[model samples]
Target: MREAVRKESEIFSELAEICTSPGYVHAIASLCYQNNILIYADKLTPEDMLQQFARDILVRTEVSTLIGLACKKQLNIDLPSPEVIQRYIDKTDSLLKEIHQSMMLPMEYIFDSNEVSDHNFNPFRDGLVLREPIFYSGESAYYFQYRDLSKIKYEKDNDWFLRNKGFSIQQVIDVVMSIQSLQNDKAKNVLRGLFDKNPSEWTVLSAYKFTAKEVSDISNIEIDTVRLVIESFVSSIGMDEFNSLDDFNPKNAYPIIQLPEDEYLLFQIYSLTQALYETPFFWFNDDKAYKNIANQHRGEFTENFSAERLKLVFGEERVFSNIDIYNSKDQVGEIDVLVVFADRAIILQAKSKKLTITSRKGNDNSLQSDFKKAIQEAYDQAYLCATLLNDKKYKLVDKSGKELNINREYKEIYPFCVISEHYPALSFQARQFLKFQETKNIKPPFVMDVFLLDVMTEMLQSPLHFLSYVNRRTSYGDKILSTHELTILSYHLKQNLWIDNKYAMMQIEDEICVDLDLAMLTRRDGAPGSDTPEGILTKYKGTVFDQIIRNIDKLEHSEIISLGFTLLSMSSNAIEMINNGISELIKRGRKDGQHHDLTLEISEGGLGLTIHCNDDHESISRPRLENHCELRKYTQKARSWFGICIGQKVPRLRFGVNKEYDWVQSNEMDELVQDLPKPQNLEGKNKINFAPATRQSKKVGRNEKCPCGSGKKYKKCCLKQEWRM
Candidate 1:
């Protein structure tokens, strides 16, 4: 008895618990059988069994979600949120319900070849061998197709179906049987409403006009037997039991009883036989299935397989090596991965997907150009090693100083892919393409699929897969264009139009000859012919090339011509503008035998301004094109007395001269003083030496009194000016 209890076979322990707690006992028995464990041997109670089932549901859901997250992280992909996952689960469950409804019909109706009136219809022949309904519905039905059978299809019986007035009695019986047996009556009616103009209203429409007694007589089964059969079938088809079988108490359990033992007995035999038939398919697994199985036992398989694959591929040496990563100045590019070997550097630019390239001349063909341009653009912007600054140093520059190689021709360049978890096929395909390129020795511009795949698998694990390297010069270009260059270019174009309009106006002035509006106008003899504004502007569009030309003209004509020339190197737009404007201006200036000395002055904070004069003299000049406008060049004298120094006892660093001292000693004094310094005071001074002895000085005397009238020492008081002041 002790040995028997220790073994706790299913029959003994499970049946024994039926007298105590049937529901818990049944669940325990099912779980024990599934796991090949003995529940009684472990002394599992009804409460324990129920808790275990709940725990299992939670565990499965958790494990699935965790695996999903891991895959997403590995591929650097964004996974759907928990709410989204929940929605997907709900949708899957809904679809399962629909499948179950389709599967709930009787085997006779599902596979019968006879007409509506045929008394003999066999379901077992059409692979509807299962007497229980659970084998046919929802996830279980899906499972069956994969586990018990290789395929499924409905056979057409056109002759039989046509003869039944487009309505087979068997089809009606099947639909009613499915509807009546289903616990979800709402779903049942909704399904029935889809098929006919009218449907009978009844709780369980198993038959028409026949009472339970009459139906039982015809079917050779009791009412309870019929109900039990439906319930068992539903269970077998993967429908969860809402209530335990033992809890099912029919109102008329033995009403019209017939073939009582044989019915249940036949169902049991069918269930056992089907399980036996599914054993081979359920147990067999291919590589794909093995992966699923391995994932299920992830705790054991993950670490071991990781190590094994690493050993196989990389041996003992670590695959990753460290290198310096600099913050790229260019916003449009980043360093996907950097590898430095003895004589070369490998830079990878990874993308989420590959562009589709075509050879035909069409929009799709532009993908090749786009691909080439993108890679070249990224390369152009990438930081060149400071040591490798000039092409001349590498013997790669021609005699004319042009680069001998295209930026894309560098062997170390690699463009890889960053991918989502579901795109393994694309990754694999891209890898094959890259490998093809490598083997064929295709040039740098060619897109290779193999390198792309490797990059996708290896580098995409990092969240920052979108990063690329951008060169400092191009980064500066981006800043310039976004700020000053674009605006200035546009302004130059506007100014050029203004000048052209003015020139046309002058030409029209020369052409017109009229006494008044009442008289007919005639062109003045030998006067410049006027051109219409539209005619002059007709050929021009605001294209980059046109802007370049206009900008050059503006630069040459600017009062600060040299400053405008310097702008050329600062920005590409500036360069284009300067070239066009300066070339034209220089040609015209040479013809006129005059040139403006335009120079640039840069302040401490890098603010630049242009000063222009007719010669080396530091004075402002008017340009012919600028409406002949002239403005004075004066050093802005400090308006307050605190900025100038003159005479003893004079205000310390005051802007104005002392009243008691001779005004002749300071230039500032000469400028500030009114009248001829009083005629009496000038009479004593030597007339030959009386050139108003004003001298300019940058510094003031400290011995002078405070300018603000504070009695303290000059240096200690107002002479020590506040910085903000």
Candidate 2:
């Protein structure tokens, strides 16, 4: 990758020079027009011109076909066919005309001015002089005159630049080929150098100093040859008028092109090269020795890269690489990268084998076969590692032979196959396989998620966000438990001491049966025929058993039992709501004088309550209670029951039930109350008054029972009233 980056940087430098040169741009534009490739030659970048020329070359099949036809029609004559000769002559004449036009076109120039000058004022009148320094703004165009040079600055948009309308890639190719066809080896070499320079190194003044001996030395060409090429190039492009080499040194006349400092330039070059060549150009010319080394070590490199990326994402403490799972007798498997987040573990298997897709027929067969093999190997390795890590009996060791402190209590394990390439079709197949496994009750030790190496690196930066993303794509069976669900469950589990364990268990079993009956009945238009309650229980149990079993070892036995009860309570509440809705519908129907029969039924394959109307047997209402929105609402409500039940927080009762045998007031009771004994009159015996006592009585403790019949503490009862009396 580093080598590729370097090569592309060099290539872009060269192209940038050609792109910014006004003479080269005009010459290319004329060639493009002559070749019938450039519909509009304005604002054309070198990249665009190359793309247009390639398209033109691909489109012109008649030229090659005609040449072949001429070859076949050759007869033994002093001169070849006149028609062929005329065709050739026409092509030559067109090329010459294009060249002449390119020379005649005025060159667009860019100049930098440190000082500003107003167009309305005469600079000479104020004794002001402006110096023109050649400036390159990475564009090609015709002559441009700034109306207000004062307004221009070196900033992005304010910089002086010129360009015609953009040209297509084919036009650029045409321009290159046109330069090639000039048959001037020196000119070709010079053009190649310009094309090779970095974008930042492209400057109008520097491009003109091609005759220097230093340039010849750097380019490995003779001085005379370089000077001859420079002279020919300037004359061809009509730049002879600007030549100042006769009176001034070439080095002093033009500024040296500076090397690019922009870090983003490398990426730009990579993108441009990718656009021009189907692959990076350097890859085609890769050294065999280096290629072999790269291929051999690619796996190790990818593994390290992935490890570092995960470390950056999840913290160094949370990520481990080159983990070896082993039994006492032998090594089991190796994990490329392991990331532990909370109680969840993400095990990654990195496959660095480069797989290619060929254009030949039946090529995909081999590709698919290799892909499947790679996927199987990655999955197997990941599964083995996860299983070992999750089992207490086995042990894991790092590369340095240090035993890892493996936590065997992981609640979730995400096995991933990280590949260098993005193969959507293969990913789809992997997803389908996982879905199939889920349906078959074949819980594959871990859910395998396939990710491109680049994508995995990006996702690792925000692990929680990535997990949520995976949760949303739950169809692949790689969903992580949502934090919301975990939070609710955790809060309830912590408060398990307050839960009525026995009552919860009993209620949960009954609720499960009731919920299953109602759910199965409402699911279809009939009663569950001969299916026993036990059988229905078995079926529903299967649905939640896998989840329950996976979590069983992670919690205490009591907690697991509590969790079962909570799930049952939630399920029951959801079913009860549906049942109540159905009952309301039935009541409304009956009030309207419509005869409807509601029955709970269970079939061997089904369990649900069904409603049937006697008036219309064919048109029975089967409320679609299974709509996801309604089901989710019920599920959430049911889930909330865990918090409510464990917390011992009962909601206020909205309705009351009446019982027989209660106290009642009657006329006889009123007469009996009048005949009850009356206390002796205290007024007749309490006439004596005593002087106020100076001493207070002994204080009574607040906890002591009150003498008053209110059964309250003495301080809270009549203790205060005694002082007032």
Candidate 3:
């Protein structure tokens, strides 16, 4: 596989002799046309298509860009015919595909050597990219973070973008923002302008490609200026002459691709977002004269961007920026941002450092260093704040040295680390390298870039919904394997994001993001994706399940987060079964002679649930339900038991019971448990209710049959047993 990659250099070199620098970038843009990319998926499922494209010939052209930097030299020779050019493209593609296939077995052998396989099944073998070429829809704050940030610090001489890139950041932003403000573009330009001449020839790639004059007209900027700044986004890599060369930092790195016909193509919408959001990451560091001041201010900008996004997701009053923690008179540490709402809190640390290009190319030492600077250090800072927030004695103060008033001592603390820009393979690398300290009080830190934070805030605007997602996302830990954080987040928008058990590994593919992308693109006043989508959590919306979850989010108690954790962690099917049982009990009550109460066992942490259907008075029904719950909790040896009452005679949610999480395994239930009923196990690992046909209680007369179904008087039928105590 390695040798095949080596031989491909020769092919790129042969092809480069015929084209210019922009030509190489152009070839990649043309080959990845939405039409060309999806041709293979026509007959296969998305997963299968993703598999096919991962090893397809069309995807290998990007390598030629890296190996052959065409801006340094130019060929004046006439280019080959269309047939000849395609032959070279096909040859390079086949060799790259062969090399991609060859990588599977050897990588598996290496993984099996040390064997992290014991903890998880090896998914490293499928090193496939999801190729979300049309993902960004301009809702993110990519432009806000990097545009004209240094104007305040440096005045004009050392303005970061101008000093480093010889162009005003604001100018580029004007063009990008204008292009984004097109006619109802659902991630593709719906504006049928001069650029889309001859619909037959124009593929999906043409929708994003635009002429400088068109941009100038829309933005009201000078055509020459628009042309220059737009050119800054174009990669200077042209057609490569086949050769293997030493790796070096690219002098001219751009995300956009330029064509011979004078149109600029953002092959993937990510290219534009990356340009506005991440372009300054290297530029600020590379400028020798202004690097110190520029880098410091860069970090501050990242902190500010994160603080704003946090404020949007969790309201402004709850979010405090640049917080200082003090114990007594001495300062403990500083937190970039701290959010405390209700009983849920978030500790955030922002870093401007990015993964070096060498790290992306697979240098282990560089990967570790870049990961440490970009994520690990931020996590360390957030974790420090998290530990302090857990203790009541520490005071969180604002810049004025006045203590920030908190509503309550937060129980569920979610720590986060936000970066300045996109880091390739960030999620996977964190799983491979992140070493967490004690995480009992707070969850594992979720690391993401500014762009992701923008999208997350836009979609999940409500504090409760965002906090619930953060709770569930952190619970999964490294069990989630994905190339991007957005993929997992996208799944949460469509379905309840939870796995059945701890050891199971879940791979969230990028294809899952298609719906989210389209939603973001086509959203207007007419319609839009719900702030919270229709998923498993919302399946029983307004039912007892929703009532409990909503009420939990608003309540104040030290141990209340524990209950929220259980409810949020319930899988999609788990909530369905419990809610469905309520409906079935109501139907059976209409038939006259049938069981009304339900006792079901949840597979989550040995938890059990019992819904009492009868509308008997609280004086009798409440205690009877409690007694029934206690028996199930002991008999099943569950961690906790929840008892609920829904009415048939009085059809509304009346009351519920919270069996304190104090289960103790002992000989207490040995004799009494032998006769008690249990929920039957049904098909599938993710079943909510095991047995749907179990019963509960009511006020028992001395002569009436025992609630346990012993068929004897309550007084004589072992009601005085020590187990009830």
Candidate 4:
């Protein structure tokens, strides 16, 4: 989107001028505090103001973060000239463009929507989709997919940085507990508040510029310890200290300014936040062995934290950690975290590796290597575990050396690679450098830092809602490009994150994550999002559909996971169509004085649902639902079928039947279905209305021959007033 402005000298000179100014550090630090921490995440400001300020604050952070590294002098954004400001804006547009061009054309993608049902665990990573793109020497043409990523968010959650730049929550506890003086819970919170405050307005910067004694007096920590902690967090530098991006490492970084009479002050808002978080780790680093232990603990904490997070999404009973696979007593591979739900599961492998310092400075080779360790290798382990699990000949065991009981036939396994730290440029790095194994019957893994995972489990609490994300993410992630994982997730939460097959590419802007950031921040404040995730289940919140979703894992049957998947796999329109059909069935049942049921198949032989309606709870019976669902399954030749029993009076779901899968042709069953009422025409009941993303006057490709039989590009042939319609 931007012309490459290669005048590095002019750009750096302008940036240096602004960064070296007296107010640049304080200005950004203040913006970071107000835009992020001051108000509740839910929009308290006017919409236009919020959007504009979000963009402005984002600009401030990128520019300020760059200069904050070594700019010990006061800094401000008052540029030497308008040309300098224009040049800075141009560079940012280039980064935005880079975020959008993240798609690679794979040779093929075969989505087997007829997924397996409960208790039938098939151990493969669902590798039918290719993760690696084929090298094509010849020319190729691609279409443009539509997405809006114009949203902006300026901060990572403060809690994320608290964990030593990369440790998980439990490790956070251990790390903070070990370093009592600096990072213990109260000290950490108070330390940041010492420098930052949420004022009524942002017109005047309101952060405290205080001495060590004033800070200690304001906080609960003892004055002597507070001085030592501040000293440990000291990270000021001379003009020569930084020359490139690589010099900025949060572990040893925070912008500060030297005041009068030999006193130095922390950049109040975000800089102090960084200093506060990174101080604890530095405090323990005085002991080499302790530091080493802490380092190893990082990986362990990631694994445990991932398992805990997964447990939150899919119940604790189904989530297993450190499950070892064996080939006749010889340990083969281990699953860091395995979450099972009937016939579907998610396999996760966590890595503590982060983006190397050199990588952050713009070294391509270092970036690739860092990604390989932090994301690719984790996927490899998870994929291997999935493949082995698919092989019935292998054995599974837990970390306790006991044989792990994994009897269900898992038909679809979503593999995930989780990182210990929030690696910047993560989404782009994945698209650019990650090389997935070319295999069959497996899906591409989604790599994310623990920060996103934590938010995901919190927002999408229902099992089906969470599973729907995995299903959609694995299906369309490669084709969609964005700057952050949260950006993509935020779009999904807002609008289901769907891309129509009509387009070949989609570019998601950063703008969509703004509301999500507010929601997440509100959730952090304990109000839990005045406007959190508004995804697939939002419309059906208290309906029986919602009840089914809430009880997906709670159902006493083995096929609940698959049923949840089947229900979630349907479009929102499809769900509404089913609801309409259920109403019709209820009316028909009242007229006929019998329990009336309907079967709504989402696709020809994909996932389908059978809903039985009755006037009262007494009229609801498992055998009746089971009979109707089984007959429907046999007739439709469906891969998976679920039965829901609804009591008309209660206007709610009374109970449900577990999903049935793996249909077999039987003459007797065929005869039985024939004796039943003839199947109704599915036109109205099965119709799913999903609008086209974009409508053009010319339906043909811009490069393809025109539809009017003119052998010219559609754009050229259709260049007329009538075509505009």
lDDT of 3 by residue, 282-363 (tens): 5556667766876777777778877887787666777888899898998988989888876678888988776564554445
The candidate 1 region of ten consecutive residues with least summed lDDT is 513-522
Candidate 1 lDDT over 103-181, as tens digits, reads 3444446655565356554332222222112121111111122211211110122232234224232332332233223
**Alpha-carbon runs more than 4 Å astray in model 4:** 1-6, 21-49, 52-56, 66-208, 236-239, 249-252, 256-258, 261-268, 274-286, 437-441, 526-531, 534-537, 556-560, 583-593, 604-607, 614-725
So what's the TM-score on candidate 3?
0.70
| Best-fitting candidate, scored by lDDT | 3
Stronger candidate by TM-score (3 vs 4) = 3
When 2 and 3 are scored with TM-score, the better candidate is: 3
**Model 1 Cα displacement at 69 (Å)?**
20
By TM-score, rank the candidates, best first. Answer: 3, 4, 2, 1
Give the Å error, residue 567, model 2.
20
Model 1: runs farther than 4 Å from truth? Answer: 1-591, 602-725
lDDT of 4 by residue, 1-725 (tens): 43344343344445555455444444444434444344324444323225533544443334444445325454342323334433444554454233222222222212233544434422122211111121101101000000000000101222433443443233322222223222223323543554464432222222433455555555545556544444544554345645433355442344344444534444333334433333444444665756676556566767877888788877778899888888887888989888887667788998867555566544546656777888888888888888887787788888777876765466678888887554655655666566676345467787776667877887787677787787877778678876567777778887776776787778777677666665654555333444565566477767656766666556634555556666665567666676666666555555555555565665667556667677533332555566667777787777767777776655566677755568899987776566444334333455533222232343567776433222334565443313543
* Cα lDDT of model 2 by residue, 1-725, tens digit: 11112232243233333323322322222232334232223432323333433422311112211211222221111232334433444453443333223222122211113323544432211100101000101111000101011011111211111121132223322222222223223333444565787643432222212223444445554555443323321211122222211111111111111122310001011112112222211222254544454343445645666677677656788789988888885888888899876556778887643333230111335444555555757777777677677777777889999988856666556676765322323332343232222212112433222222333333224444343233323322323222111121212222211223233211111112222222222222133332222321233333222233223322323223332332233333333443343344344444554332222211111222222222221111111111211222222222211110000021111111111122355454343234222211112232222223222245658776443222335564445444444
Query: Could you tell me every candidate's TM-score relative to the true structure?
Result: 0.16, 0.32, 0.70, 0.69
Predictions in order: lDDT:
0.25, 0.34, 0.59, 0.55
lDDT of 1 at 280: 17
